[model samples]
Target: MHDSTQSRRTARNSLLIMVCTLLSRLLGIIKARVLGSVFGATAIADVINFTFNIPNNFRKLFAEGAVNAALIPAFSSLLGRNEKHRCVRLFALLCTFQSLLLIPLVLVSYFYGDGLIAFLSDFDANQVRLGGRLLPFFMVYLATISLASIFNGVLQAHENFLHAYLSPLLFSICVIFGVWFLSDRYGAMSMAYSVLGGGLLQGSYSYLMVRRYEYRFKPMLRPQNAPFKEVLVAWALVSLGMGMQIITQMVSFLFASHLSEGSVTAFTNSTIFYQTPYGIFFNAISAVSLPLMSRAAASNNAPLLRTYTRNSLLSLLALLLPSSIILFFLSRESVSVVLQTGNYTLADATLTALVLRPYLVFMVFSAWYALMLRLGYSANRHALMTRIVFLQNLLDIALMWVFLKLGLDIVSLPLANGIAYTLGLFILFFLLRDLFPLTKEARFFKGLLRIVLANLPVLAFCIFYKNLGLQWHESGSSFANLAYLMLIGSAALGIMLLSYKIARIPLLSLLRSKKHGGNLQGDNLIHLD
Candidate 1:
């Protein structure tokens, strides 16, 4: 009874987070459109995008709940034994240490950001100088976001998710406003200033949220405690895993830079399109699952852990499969409609869509890799996760290098990423096989087959949708492009609904879920817990 009730709460929280994430993702598109409209795919655009990518990558390791994942286990462990005061102190101490470490890092990046920019890209001296100057603003962004993550971690550990989820939305809003109002004068530099304000506001909001609790900001530095030691180790391991990704992305930037004048923008923007699907589905699942899975792991609750894992996997595929297909088919149209306005030309949008095709493949497998990676954190299998991640990252880098040597030109960037994600998904899945035990194989595959069947027709429709007298060709107007995509989307929706009906899938059971039922072995519809 208790477990079922908790599951209900979890579902509610996940839904709430999903809605919040959807808002943030939309706001992000606005930011992208604003930036793209102002600078198009020029060097200034590349420089701005690349500069943000630096601190953005750094911030992601902290932002995407690695801090929460690390801290949750420690907090869970301590609270399991009734040591609440220590949890508070440890939170304070960890925050103190994070700030201390961030200061010097920020100083270095701020002072020599141009040199760092030059080292990372093939930009000429002037563009390098421009990127360098902007790096300081984003570095400040890194600090603010990094600091915000600690508070987010604490709030999430307490299972207070609303404020933690809102920080990103708030940050995006600030960035959009700053860029819109200040851009004419500050130009690209306005983005930097906006980032500064956004980060500060984001950090402040989280701090205020945390203040409502008994957690302190006294700046304690007692790292020798056993609880603190466990947290430090967990955080270190998590950082190591994230560090591999950070390196992989930086190398990707290097490869993209050499490809062409605007390759960096295309490469990065294509990946940005990826955020739509991930945020709408996988992000919510992972956010809600991670802390729950951590608790389940700590208490050795195998049944509960199995349920979360299976449902999360089902939810992701059920959502991502069709979503990836539609985007894959409409890649050019999607990019064109979303970004090809103002200064951003159709040629630039076309280049980005081509880059997006491979990323769609990467994005699908990436969902699995990410979910399993969290499972690794839940199980505290950091060393194993570390190895798996590094292996994948190294393979990706090597493949990128080989592709360049093979004279594949710009294809090397996304091709290497796609291969790495495909291989990494298999590797992680194999390593985490115990979570999806063989006894459940019959049900898992059945549910998976049903999901596949439901999407097969949608895939077919996407393949030849333009052939049915749909005037989806270029019309030189953004409204026309958007309307065509909308029509296609509406038609696709009808196909999926009919397909679901034909498959006898219960569409509402998952949404109005009253209890956690079934698993990966369900016969028709996916049964969400």
Candidate 2:
């Protein structure tokens, strides 16, 4: 009975988290629009992007991917054991240690900002110098936000969803306000300070909310005998794996930096836009699956773990397959509607649309690989995950080089990403063959193939429709162009749905499935043990 109640609570918390994430994405679009209008696809935006990537990468390494991956499972286990005091102590230690560490990291990044920017940025002399100037301020921004992420993760693990959800909203508020008030007077540099101020506000906001939960912070290095050390070490190792998965991001960024003054900004904006659907589907699956996987592992229910893993994989494919198609067809319209504003001209929109078309192809593959990695981690197959990460990274770099050599240009980066993800998925399957029967594996692949085949008609129709839409009168208004494309695109999507029904594919299987509460209610899932 207690287990049933606990499961209900987890489900509720997961729902809250998902809602918050969706809100963040919405705010993210708004913020991007504001920045796009103000800065456009110019050198100033490029410098801001370059400066921001430094801390953003670090955050992914520690706060989002690494720390949260380690903390949630370990913390869940600790809490499962009823060791509440120890859990609180662990949070305090991390908060304290990170606070001290961030100070130095921020200082170093700021003081040596110019040199670092010059080294990392492959750009014209003027752009490089400007990027370097933006680095110190952005470094401060990254540092504070990264620290805030720690608290956010803590709140997430505790299943305190509200505070965690609001943190990013707070960030977006500060940024919009800062840009609105200061961008005019101080120009591009003021945006940097706005980012820093937003970061501070976000961090303080999270910290205060955390205090309300009775998790007080203290500054001490007492090796508090707990799983903190083990988890930290494990997280570091896992981050190496996660970091490798994105090795192509760094490579592509470096290569793109060499292209032109505005190339980096264009690429970054393209990435952000493409990431929206990825985040919606990928994050949704991972959020629900990880805790379930951890629970299954803790209870020693291998079969249930396998079942959950399979469901999560299918859910990802079901979403990504269609999303990739939509992205390919609507790339231009999406860019115009979401990003084309103010300083962002038609040319900038066209460029971003061009790059985004190929970038979303790996959505399904990467989502599946990410699920496999988490499943492996939950089952304590850390070594397997580590090796996969290493190989995936190696493959990414090799593919990036091949694409460049072949003159594939900007699209090659995502193409490399797609190749790596494809390889990773197969490797994960082979490694988990015992858990997933050979026949079942065949069925999964068949289902995925059917989904792709099912969407082909829709893709073809959209291609034809888009050509026609482009021909209909040339209105200089971005909105008019977008509306026409969307009208045509909607018709295409409608046809796609009809085709899915004719093909007898479960087109909305994911949506039809039980959502948050459904995972815990009126189901035999709990008895799978």
Candidate 3:
């Protein structure tokens, strides 16, 4: 009965986060369209991409990735122990300390922004100088979003996901309006200022939500506080692990910057396309399951922890496999319809699509790695996760180096990322064998095989439909191409649903259980044990 209830809660939370994330991603896609139309794939776009990448990468490291990984598990454990007051205190302390820490960092960034931009990007001196002027504005996000992440972590610990996810949409909206209205006058600097504005709004909204949840902010900074100490200990390892991953990405982008003129822009654009579906689906599940898994681990409920871990992985594979296939087969059409407007030319679309195609190959592995890292965190295995991430980064750098040596150019970046993630997924599975074995009754490989097999018809239909003499580029109109692609995609989806139904795959059944309150244990297609 408890298992059933927990499953329902996980589904509910996942649904809430997923819906908001889908909406946000949709808005973000529009934002990307606006960026592509206004900026095109030019040196200005490359400058903006590289400038934004630095602070945004740190935001992930300090705010989203490390802080959440360390804080959420500890917060959840505190809640499990009925230590609400300490949790609140720890929250305030984190906020205060992060604020104090960011002030000096922001100042340093302002002073050294030029050298930092030049070091990270391969742009010429003039462009790098312009990007340096923009870096400080983006650097402000490091403070704003880091504080917001603490509020978000608190909300997630309390299972209040709605506000936490919706707050980011404001960031996207502000950037869109900034680019639309101010880009002509102030150029990319307007967009940089808009990012700062968005971060402020997002952080403020998160702070309000924290207050609404009855956690008053008293601005405490207690270095010796036990809970704070615990968070710091976990945080160091988690940050190191996540920092390695983010650094690997920065290195890849650095390589892209050195490639062709618009290689950085193309790479960034293609990554946004890949991340849309990933954030909407895979990330939503991981976010919801992490706290539950932490609670299970705190109580030493190994069975429940294993169940959550397995279900999350299977769910990821079930969705990611089909999505990847579609993206891989229809990369060009997808990129064209979404981004081909105004300054973005046909060559730009073709280049982005080329980078996107191989990137989709390991989308499932990316999702799996995300979930596994959360699983490791839940079990307080941060040191192990750090080791895995460091090794993964090493592997990624080695692969990218090899590809560059072979003269692969810009495409080598995403290809290297995909290959490294695939290798990392295997490494993580073996590393987490003691906490959550992959060979349990919910056999990971067997279930993955089922998902892939069920997707075969959909893949076949997409191929057959594409060969029917309809070409996106030659279709003469974007609307016409979009209509045809939608038609074919809908049919492919229908075929996938039918295949799942005929095969009694567990994906749909799990979703149905969420709505109907049915027992997933009785769904013979899945092994819960």
Candidate 4:
């Protein structure tokens, strides 16, 4: 009964995140169109994307990803034990430590920002100089959002998710309105200023949310505190993994710089599109999974842990597999409809689509891999997580070097990303197979096989849809391109759901399935049959 209640709660949270993520991503698409229309996928766009992304990468390494990975589990455990006071102290300590570290980072970016930008990007002298001016604003954003994530993690630990998704949505809105209203006046510089404003707003909202929850700021810095030490231990390991990610991102920028003019913009925007579905599906699940998994692992319940792991994987693959397949097949039309307006030309869209197709593989497998890491975090398996992240990053760089040398041009970026993630996924499967109860359930494999079978026809429909759309009109009008997308997308989704129904797969139940709740509620899931 408790598990069932948890399931409903998680469903409501996931539903909230999905709705907000959908809105934010759509606004994000509009932001892309504005940037493309106003700036095109040229040196300016490349510079803006690269410069901003560099600090955002640091934000992942130092702030949100690292903090959430460490803080969420500890927070969940503390809250579960009715130790809210200790949790607040832990939060304050982490914030102090983070401030101490991030202060130096912000200072470096301000003082030596251009040199850092130059090192991270391989742009020409002119582009480098232009990008240097924008780095400070993005770095400030990095600092603000990083700090806000502390409170964001607090909300997630409580399963009160007002701040987690809103920050990015605010960021996107700032970019869209700033570009639309101020582009003619302040030009691209207006976008930079808006980013600074967005970051302030993000920090503000998080602060307000914490206050509303009746949590006050109690700053305590005690390095010898065991909870603080434990989180530091986990955070250090997580930061190592995120550092590798940061390194790979920087290297990719360098690679993009050498590829061609505007290659950085293509690479960056392709990544944004790849994240659209991932944020919708896995982000919400992971949000709920981490807290519950932490509670289970803290109780040392192996069976429950395994169940959560297995079910999360099932939920991910159930929706992700079909979506990825269709999106992979429809990458071109999808890119055109979303980004091919204004300065984002047919040629530009084609370049981005080429990159986005292979990247779809990363989008799928990385979500699976991320769930495993969260499992590791919950179970306090930091060393193993470290090694897995290392292997993934190592393979990515090695494959990227090999692919670029093969002269695959800009497409080599995502191609290597796809291949590395695919390989790392198998390695994870081998290493973590014991944690998955698949062999215990013979029918699991059968269901997965059925899902694979279902995706086949979805694949066929996507291909047929693609060929059919080509006969009507390929480009020239965004409306025609969007209509083409709507037709194919609606059909592909219907086919996927219907196919799952024929196979007796409760797709909606999977969506709402909590860590301990796998059974269905009639009201919670759609009755497909």
* Model 4: worst 10 consecutive residues (lDDT sum): 520-529
Error of 1 at 429 (Å): 2.7
lDDT, candidate 3, 245-315, per-residue tens = 77787798888878888788899889888988888887677787788778878988776677677767777
- Give Cα-based local distance difference scores for all models: 0.77, 0.71, 0.79, 0.77
Clashes of 4: 0
Better lDDT candidate (1, 3): 3
TM-score on alpha carbons, each prediction = 0.84, 0.78, 0.85, 0.84
Flag regions of model 2 displaced more than 4 Å.
1-19, 32-50, 109-140, 184-189, 242-247, 254-270, 332-355, 406-409, 434-470, 473-477, 491-529
Q: After superposition, how far is residue 18 of candidate 1 from its true place, in Å?
A: 2.7
Per-residue accuracy of model 1 over 1-529 as CA lDDT, tens digit each: 6645655566676677778988987887788778778778898889998888888777766655568668766675566456778878888888788788888878998788878988999999989988988998888888888888888877776767788898879899998889889989988899889999999999999999988878777777666554777677878777887888888888889888888787898888888897777767776777777776777777777766766676677667777788888888888788877777766777888788888887776676788788888888888887788788889899999999999999877778888977987898788877788865735556556766888888999989987874565435344347777787888888887888788777765443332122344543333244444
Per-candidate Cα RMSD to the true structure, in Å, reads: 4.0, 5.2, 4.1, 4.2
> Which residue segments of model 1 deviate by more than 4 Å?
1-7, 33-54, 61-65, 76-83, 106-138, 182-193, 223-226, 258-265, 341-351, 401-409, 438-440, 464-471, 501-529
Scored by lDDT, model 3 comes in at 0.79
TM-score of 2: 0.78
Tens-digit lDDT track for model 2 on 1-529?
Answer: 5545654564455456557777888887778878888888898888887678777877777677777677776666666566778878888778777777677877776677667777887777777777666776776776677667777766766667668767878888888878878888988877887888888898899989878767787875775666668777777788887687567577789988877566777788888877877886677567656656766676676666665666567657756777788777777677777666667776787878777776777777788888888877776677678888898878878888889889887766777877888898889878967655535555356555666777888778867866665633223346677677678668877877787676665433332222221332222222111
lDDT of each residue in 1-529, candidate 4, tens digit only = 6556765666667777878879987886688778889988678888898887777667877777888998899988777777787777787787777778877877887788778878987888888777778878887888888878888888888888646777668877877787778888987788789889888887878878877756665656774443898888888899999999888988999999998887998899888878888889888778877887787778776666766666677667777888788888887777777767666787887788788888786676778888888887887778788888898998899889998899998888788887787887777767766665445745345445666786787988877866665633246346766786788789899998887777666665544443443433333231110
Error of 1 at 67 (Å): 2.3
TM accuracy, model 1: 0.84
